[model samples]
Target: MWSVPVLPFKQLISSALFCALSGLAQAGSDLRADDSRLKSLETTDAGRDWEAVGRLDRLGEGFCTGALIAPDLVLTAAHCLYDRDTLEQIDATSIEFLAGWRNGRASAYRSVKRAVLHPSYVYDGTLSATRVRNDIALLQLQRPIRNTTVTPFETDVRPRKGARVGVVSYAQDRSEAPSLQEVCTVMARQDGVLVMSCDVDFGSSGAPVFSFEGERPRIVSVVSAKARVEGNPVSLGASLADELALLEAQLTGTHVGSQLPHGVSRVQVGEPRRRDMGAKFISN
Candidate 1:
């Protein structure tokens, strides 16, 4: 029951025309920012409990949202470990995780020693549901963080379509501190990718999607991109249950050493992805 906001006549006309041309199906309206629920953690009470969700700093160049899954393991989008302009893999040593970051301080900080992506993940300049499904990466920390305040999250199964979910992300405008969308919905599940009705932006890539099922929260997906499908602003994510297991198995073997199968050096020329659909495929 969300209505489009009143806009100037020209803007409204242009919007209508754009929707028509895009062939977007008119479904539910996009999510609205209440500020009360999705407000900045820097000035909110919810910030006190979200210590495990941290910022993945890529050598001061940029950042992406990440969360700790183990004492020495951090989870994020595979694309975040590469440079967008050059498409080159950023050295794992150059990345750091700032847990519970707020006002230029962090409860725990650990540098990355290695990173592993899904073996099937290849950046072939194509954007598809399968690509997003395998867009996960695991960062091995140089040192383990054994703090009570920064407990790692547990992984869980993917939620069904129309299920209620939540997201914690550090976006472009709110990069200083993370924000929590306590209420978002899974719009659809195409192939292995999830299209969610959550609000995300540039730095929101790799943000953790959570499900409040039991006593503790469990991670279900990793944010990959934001898009406008049939006029509805939706966020894309990859289910983590299978992806995490594969990455863990890769890390357990020597595949992560000299014979890294998911190394970022792999790329190929192919159909360029569509960027005009509000898809911000950013490293952040």
Candidate 2:
């Protein structure tokens, strides 16, 4: 198993964490019991429906899972764009989005031209409700994909606690092909962070969390970290509705902030972090 950082359960119950998560709670029906298992989307037939989800490769360093939100826009975790070692931002030119990547090939390949992180996001190699609540990023491709098979997904509001959700991602063990967990429940929602019973691991960062409530699956959140809540493993993500709007504004120069920096940063691969006060964030 990958040696990941562990946050104490007591810390989560404290006021510091709870204050960071204060927000209005939505009411939704409880999730029905279902067999939650990871199904490999290795075959073309089985993976056709999820063509927009792909691997965000940092060249020789490591990769994180991302999904297309528009013809030239990709959504992922903000931490994925920061180097774990130096806490520096990665260059957009060095990152590539392998849309519908399976086996040894991809449906469409595009280099990232720009990346915008949530303005409130800070990468200090720590985990907190504030960081997780803003742990989202948007990437602009050098060129539009415009592929028939690679249709972008629609974004939606955050799911209520106990709602059923799904995740498709590539991990350390399943690096070549992505796997789908079709039935994970939102265990809790605090402030703007979501804690779900989704199965994720290293390299699963930035993976899209889909809500199947409408006619089609819509992205509700992006996997930020995997944590053990009171001994049960859970995945953490930021509610996309508000955060996504801010990112889009920033990308279009409508938001009041500095433009995204241009430079190169490396990804941290298979590095064990010191067990401290934060959850096991997957930044590889």
Model 2, 161-276: lDDT tens digits are 67889999998888889999999887667667777778888889999999898898889889988754434466778757667777777777664333434531111111111122
- The lDDT for every candidate, in the order shown, is 0.71, 0.76
For model 1, what is the error of residue 261's alpha carbon versus the real structure, in angstroms, after optimal superposition? 21
Model 1 — which ten-residue stretch has the worst lDDT? 1-10
Q: Tens digits of per-residue lDDT for model 1 on 213-260?
A: 858878888898775555556677885755676687677674422443
The global Cα lDDT (0 to 1) of model 1 is 0.71
TM-score of each: 0.78, 0.80
Which ranges in model 2 have alpha carbons more than 4 Å from their true place? 1-35, 255-284
RMSD (CA, angstroms), candidate 1:
9.7
* Model 1 segments more than 4 A misplaced: 1-25, 28-37, 229-231, 254-284
What shift in Å separates residue 84 of candidate 2 from its native position after superposition? 0.7
Residue 155 displacement in candidate 2 (angstroms): 0.6
